[model samples]
Target: MTAEDLSTGHTAIGSDPALDSKIKNYYTPARIIGTDYTYKHKIVWKNAIGFLILHLLALWGLFIFFTGGVGIKTALWAFFILFISSEGITIGAHRLYSHKSFTATPLLRGILLTLQTIAGQNSMYIWCRDHRLHHRYSDTDADPHNAKRGFFFSHIGWLMSKKHPYVIELGKRIDMSDLEADWMVMFQKKYYYPLYALFALFIPVWVPVQYFGESFKNSLLVCYFFRYLFQVNGTWLVNSAAHLFGTRPYDQNLQPVESWFVSWLSFGEGWHNYHHTFPWDYKAAELSMHFNVSAIIIRWLEKIGLAYNLKTASTEMVAKRIIRTGDGTHYALGNDDAKARVTAIGPLHPFNPSYTTKYEAPGANLNDQGLPLFHEMDVINVNNKNIKRNFTKA
Candidate 1:
C-alpha cells in the first residue's frame, strides 16, 4: 500500500490546491464520475445464486445431521467459519480499518485482511471509501446506505443502483494514506481475489476433507459457501435492520439505533448509534457493558505487541453523549460538548462547576433543546453600601 498505490485513481492528499481552496465550500460539493453508472445484471444474478445455494446447503446439512451423515464436529466447523468471517468484516474492516479505532501489527493486519476477504465483500479501499461517505452523510441522500431511503435501499439497493455520483468516483475522496504506507495492505489489495479463492474456498474445503474424511463438495457447500452467505447478510443487517429497528442509546440525531440482538450477531457492532456518535472509540459497547469481542481481540494483539494506539471513548465522555430521556426532557450532551469538556478542560470537569456547567431551569424542568443540563446553582448577593448609586448607574 504505497502512497502511490493508494493515490492511484484518487486525488492526492493535500495536493490539489483548488480542492484545498474550497475546504469550507458548501455550495458546490465534489463529484466523482467516469465509472459505469449501472450495476451489471449478471452480478446481481450471481449474488442471488450464491445466496440461494448457501441456504440450500444449510438445509441439506441439517438433513445430513439427522441422517447421521454429518456430525456435530462438522456443524461446529461451519459455524466457526461464519463467526470469523462476520467478525472480520465488523471488527477488521469496519472498526479497525475504516474507523481507525486501533492499530495492528503487520501479522495481525494480514490475518484480519485475509478474514475480511473471505467475507466476500468489496476490497478494503472500496469498503472504506463507501463507509466514510456513509458516516459523512448519514441519513442524507449522499449516504451510501441511508436507512431513511427505505430498508431495502439501505440493505442492498444502494449496491444495485448507479444513481449516486460518489459511488462511481469512490476512490477519489477516500484517504487511505496510512493503509497505503503499509506493504501488507497493498499486498492484500492486489491479491485479494486469489487469496479469497485459496484460503476461504479451497483451504476450508481441503482441510476438512483431508483431516475429517468429509467430502470436498460437502465441506465447500457447508463450511465455505453457507458460512460466507450467512456472514455477509449478518454484516449487511447492521446497515439495514440495525438502522431500521432497535432503540437509540446515543444519538437520536441519526437514525441508526442500538440492538442487543444485532450486537450479539455482529460481535458488538449492533451498537450502531454509539458507533456513529463516537467513530474513533474502539469499544462501541462502552464500559462495564457487553464486552466488545472485536475490541478484545485488538487488545489481545496489543498485549502481545502486535497492535497499538487502541482508541476508545472515555467513560465520562461516552456517558455525556449517551442519550437518556425522561419526563419529556431529553438529556445527553452532543459530541461537540463531549469533546470540548473532555479534551479541553479534562474529563473531571464534568463534575467541577467552575470549569463546566449546564443550563438549569429556575423553577420548572426544561424541555429538550438538543443540549444537556445539570442541576441549578443558587446565586448569592453581596451587600454594598453604594447599592442606590449602583442602581442609579444601571
Candidate 2:
C-alpha cells in the first residue's frame, strides 16, 4: 500500500521516455486512514437520475411480463442475453482478467468482452482496475464498495455517490500493464462509447424485437432496461449481500462470506469466504460447477480448447488453512482470527508520492499487481515487454 510497497519488482512500463516521464512526474501524497478521509457523500446526479429512470422503466417491464404481454420466447431471449452479459463480468472480467485465475485465447476474450459489453458495465479495463482495487485494499476507505460503509453503500449507493478520495488514488496504484498489453481490451476501451451502445443496448433488444416478433416498447423495457438493472444488481450482490450476510467458513476473519443465494444470483461468485481465502482458485469455490453457472461455462470453454492454464488451490492447501483459521462449519465472532483481525489488518494501497516531474501519471503502479496476486497473477513478462515496446513505438 505504501509507495515503496508498489514500486518494488516493477520495471518501467512504456519504453518511451516521455511516457515514463509523464507517469513518474505525477503523484500527490494523501492521507490513507483518518477522519479527513471522510467525505460529504456527494451525489452524482447524472447517474442517480439515470438509475431512477431505469428503475421506473423496470417497474413497467415487470408489470407487462406478469400481465401476459411478453411471450415465452421473448422472455427466454431476455434471460439468455442476461446470462451472457453477466458472464462477461463474472468469467470474463472478474475471474479471467482481474484475478488471472484462467487464461483465454483471443477468440474467447472477444466473446467474453462482447457479452460484458452487452451487460452495460464500464469497459473491461476500468472494470478490472476497480476490482483489483477492491481486493488489494478491501474493507477500507480505498475499497470501491467497502461493505463496512453499509449494505446500501456497497450495493449501489457507491455508484450514485461521488468516489471517496482514496478510491481514486489507490486505484491508480493497481498494476494494469497486462490489460494494456491486450489488443482487444484496448480496442474496446478506445471505442467504448459506441461499442457499449451498439452491443449492450442496441443489439440485445434488436435481436428479440426484429426476430421474435416482440413489440418495441415491451422488448425495450423487458430486454434492455429491466434486464440491465437485474444483471448489475446480481453483480452488486457479491459486493453487498455476500459481504454482509453469509458464513465465513473458510476464514472467519475476513468480511466475505459464502452465500448460496448470492452464488445463485451472481453466477457462482457468492462463495465469498472461499474466494477471498484462496483468490487464485479458478472455481471460486471448492466445487466447480455445482450451483456455479460461471464455472460451468468456463469448463465448457476449456473443453473447446479456448481456455487454458486454469489455476486452483489444492485440497491440502484448503485443509491446512481451514484447520488454522476456520471450523469449516459456520461464521461466528469472538474467534482467534477475529481477535487478531480486530482491526482487519491488511496492506495499505495508499496514494503514491515522490514524483519529481511536472505531468502526473494516473499514479499507476508500474509494479501494481492489480490485486493481491495471491498464488497467481503471474504471466508472460516477455509478452508484456514486447507489448510495452510496441506501445512506445506507436
Candidate 3:
C-alpha cells in the first residue's frame, strides 16, 4: 500500500481556520469531493511548524544538557514533571472529562485542570471534542487519530495536517450539549493559551530554579521543554503504540489493543482493548489498578470525597465479552471452566454480589431511553444468552 493508503486513506483540502469557528458552518464546499468522501491534500503549516519546533527543542535539550554536564537535580525534575503531566492527560483529559467515568469535586477538578494546562495539551473542551469523536468512529475516516492510517500519521501527523472534513462533519454530530453546560470547562477554553504558558512552561522552570538553585538554562531544557515532549509522546502512544503493537482481548473486531509498555508511559491508559470494550469503567482495565496510577488516584479522590459515582463493568459482563468477542489473549481466571476457558485479557476480578444485584437486573444497565448505556468506545452486543455470570474465583 502507498503511504496515504497505509496512513488511513484520509484527505484534507482548503485549510481555513475561519470555518472552524462554528461547527454548523464548519464545512467548506470547495473541500468536499466525490461520493466516497475523498478530498485533496492540505497541510496546516502552523501545526506542522509547531511540531517541528517541539522535536528540535527536545533533541537540543537531550544533546546539550546530557552531554554538557546537567545536574542530577534537573534530571529528577524532568522525570517528576513527566509523571505529573502524563497524569494530567490520562486522568484529567481522558478519564474524567472525556469518559465521565467518575464524578470529581470542584477542588479535584481545579487541580486536574491546572495539571492539564501544565501538560500543555489543549484545553479539556477541545481535547474531549476530538477524543469523543475518535472513540465513536474509531478506525474509520471520522476518527481523528485512526490507527489504520499508520503509526506516524496516527501518532502525530493528524495534528500536523488540516482535519479531514469528515472529522468536522461527524464531529459536529456528537452531542457537545453537555460540554457547553460546564462553565469551568468553558473557562479553561476561553483562557487556554495564557494558562498553558503560565502553568506548563513558566512554573516548571521556576520551581527548580527557585527551590533548588538550578541554572535557568538547565531548568528550561530538562524541566520544561523535554518534560513537555515526554508527556506529549506518551499521549500519542495511546493512538499509535497501543493500537498497533498490543493484543486485542476484549474485542478483536476493534483495532485498539492492550499495550503494557504504553500503559507504563501514559499512567494506565494503555489497556486499549479493555478501554474500547468498556469505556465507562473507571479503572479502564479488567484487572487491578496496580499498573494504573490514574485509577489509584481516582480511588484516593473517592476516599477524600473529591470523587464519586465511580463506574465499573460487572464481572459477568467482562467475562462474557472475553468469551465471545475477545481475541483469546488475556489472563486466565477462576475455577469455573467456562470463564477460565476464555479468560485471556487480564487478572480476573471477583464478582461482588451487592454490586451485581444493583446493576444487573433485566435491562439494568440500559439508559432511560431503553438503549444500552454507550460510552465513546464501548459497543454492547447483548444478543448472546449463554453468558456465564460467575466470577468468584481467579
- Number of backbone collisions per candidate, in order? 2, 4, 7
Best by lDDT: 2
Native-referenced Cα lDDT, model 2:
0.73
Which 10-residue window in model 1 sums to the lowest lDDT?
385-394
Candidate 3: tens digits of C-alpha lDDT, residues 129-244: 88887776676566787666678878998888777777778677666666679888899999999998888888889987988788888788778777788779889988987776
Judge candidate 3 at residue 71 and give its lDDT: 69
Candidate 3 — which residues are off by over 4 angstroms?
Answer: 1-41, 333-394
Q: Cα RMSD (Å) between model 3 and the true structure?
A: 13.2
Best-to-worst lDDT order: 2, 3, 1
Clashes of 2: 4
Candidate 1, superposed: residue stretches over 4 Å from native: 1-68, 169-171, 288-291, 323-394
Model 3 residue 98 CA deviation (Å) reads 0.6
Best candidate, TM-score: 2
Cα lDDT of all candidates, in order? 0.59, 0.73, 0.69
Q: Least accurate stretch of 10 residues (summed lDDT) in model 3?
A: 353-362
Clashing residue pairs, backbone N/CA/C < 3 A, model 3: 7-149, 8-149, 330-344, 330-345, 331-344, 331-345, 334-394
Candidate 1 vs 2: which has more lDDT: 2
Selected candidate, larger TM-score, 1 vs 2? 2
- lDDT score for residue 186 of model 2: 96
